[model samples]
Target: MQNKNIIITGTSRGIGYEMALQFANAGYNVLAISRKTPQILIEHENITCLPIDISDENQLQQVNEFISKTLKKVDVLIHNAGSLLHKNFTEITTQEFQNIYKVNVFAVAELTKICIPFMEKGSHVVTISSMGGIQGSMKFAGLSAYSSSKGAVITLSELLAEEYKENGIAFNVLALGSVNTEMLQEAFPGYEAPLSAKEMADYIYNFALTGNKYYNGKVLQVSSTTP
Candidate 1:
């Protein structure tokens, strides 16, 4: 754990921030990426804060370079960055919908492609999805764009798991329920969540390291509530 290289995006705040902090505290090398670098990570020597808009494919070259120079191999890659649009279905513009997918879906694929070469056998790729992505889950009205984008990534993870299974790499998606995240607040104001960001990040931290041995190409719905 002390020597492993973990790349986790969306570390500016919320669950991503906690995940980065926890991994750093555990003595692992954490490459934390987000549009804005979180100050909390600045204090941790093991954590490398990379502030970049991951939605842009062009900006991903920085990550590629970082991995090539800093860490040749990636032990874990967690796609935790996401975009949320809480407007009604009809009110959402085409660009807004595409922007959501750009962060939640396209960036996941683009970043994974760049990290695959640095992954070795026993490496794991964990994608952070939403409960809305699950089929038959309680659907929200203003989340058409966000929910569908989440679901798209779920399928993407499944396919990647199969494609990379022979290479000894594993891919899995966690469709999480409501969590006390700023994005959640934007999506549903005044709604209390059953879990906190730290709690869920802890679960994901453990899962990324050990879950591959038992699960791959699987979607784990990590939720305790309907909403």
Candidate 2:
């Protein structure tokens, strides 16, 4: 991954921040986007932190232009930003549902669409999904909106993989179980500490770099069973 240009969303904290550090440490040029600039990325030679909200298509277009001018090709694009609404289906308003969909599903699709043109064969796209997307459970009482949005993200990755297969672009979704991130803590306060963000980042970075052949279009679940 050395010297490759990669764009990672949601890098202010948690999994996204960890992923940015991992990629930068591997000598990859990282364009880290978040609502606020992260301190760790301020002075890094290999990292460029941009304050961007993925839901804003205009801002993403600006980002697209900046990247296209700075780098010849975008080697990887990681859609790691998402939102969660921990409310039951009956309690959620239509606007709330739309808000979650806007961030988790719509933003992902839009960003991918804009970035795909600058990508070449052997490029990889990774989306951060959740295990809640695959199976429903009784542990969470108010996760309908969050879970549904994640399910859409998985489907989006699958469809993109098929559509771009002829172009040799690989797309994969990393469906993580509970991880010890701020979002997980907010969603499940009483749960024990799960996988560390760094651990998950390592797995994701490795998969993006080396697992392309066997894992494309597949939802690789990262849980207790995952190494």
Best by TM-score: 1
Per-candidate TM-score against the hidden true structure:
0.98, 0.93
List runs of model 2 lying over 4 Å from the truth: 135-139, 225-227
Lowest lDDT 10-residue stretch of candidate 2: 132-141
TM-score, predicted candidate 1 vs. hidden true structure: 0.98
- Measured with C-alpha atoms, the lDDT of residue 143 in candidate 2 is 84
Query: lDDT of candidate 2 vs native?
Result: 0.84
Off by over 4 Å in 1: none
Candidate with the greatest lDDT versus the true structure: 1
Task: For candidate 2, write residues 53-105 as lDDT tens digits.
Answer: 87877887878787778876888988889898887779899999988888899
lDDT score for candidate 1 against the true structure: 0.94
